[model samples]
Target: MQEIKATMAGSVWKILFKEGEQVGANEDVVILESMKMEIPIATEKAGTVKEIKVAEGDFVNEGDVIVVVA
Candidate 1:
């Protein structure tokens, strides 16, 4: 299993992948907004999306889990 974590503190702007969806390595799955900038979060491992831990507009701190892949 692999955990996709936020690289910076920000509000979740969008979720691009759904649970049970297959994702490739380095695919962007979530977009976050902070300091008027958009940050895209990508998975480091190829796998199915098992869970999404954050929702759109949700605030997350750096290192917070955003999604899980397994």
Candidate 2:
């Protein structure tokens, strides 16, 4: 299992993938907004999305767990 975390404090603007969705390595999983810029979060490995810890429009802090893949 692998945990994906927010790299910076931001609002979760969109969730690109959902639980049980298959994702490839380096595929973007979420999009966040910070400093008026869009930031995309990507997966480090190919796997199924096991959990999504943050929802769209939710504010997240740096290092907050955003998704779990296994």
State the local distance difference test value for candidate 1: 0.97
Clashes of each: 0, 0
lDDT per residue as tens, model 1, 1-70: 9989999999999999999999999999999999999999999989999999988999999999999999
After the best TM-score superposition of candidate 2, give how far the Cα of residue 57 lies from its true spot, in angstroms: 0.5
Residue by residue across 1-70, what tens digits does model 2's lDDT show?
Answer: 9999999999999999989999999999999999999999999999999999999999999999999999
Give the clashing pairs for model 2.
none
Tell me, by lDDT, which candidate is best: 2
Worst 10 residues of 2 by lDDT: 12-21
Candidate 2 similarity to native, TM-score? 0.98
Q: Model 2, which residues run further than 4 Å from truth?
A: none
C-alpha lDDT score of every prediction, in listed order: 0.97, 0.97
| Candidate 1: 10-residue stretch with minimal lDDT | 38-47
As a whole number from 0 to 100, the lDDT of residue 64 in candidate 2 is 98
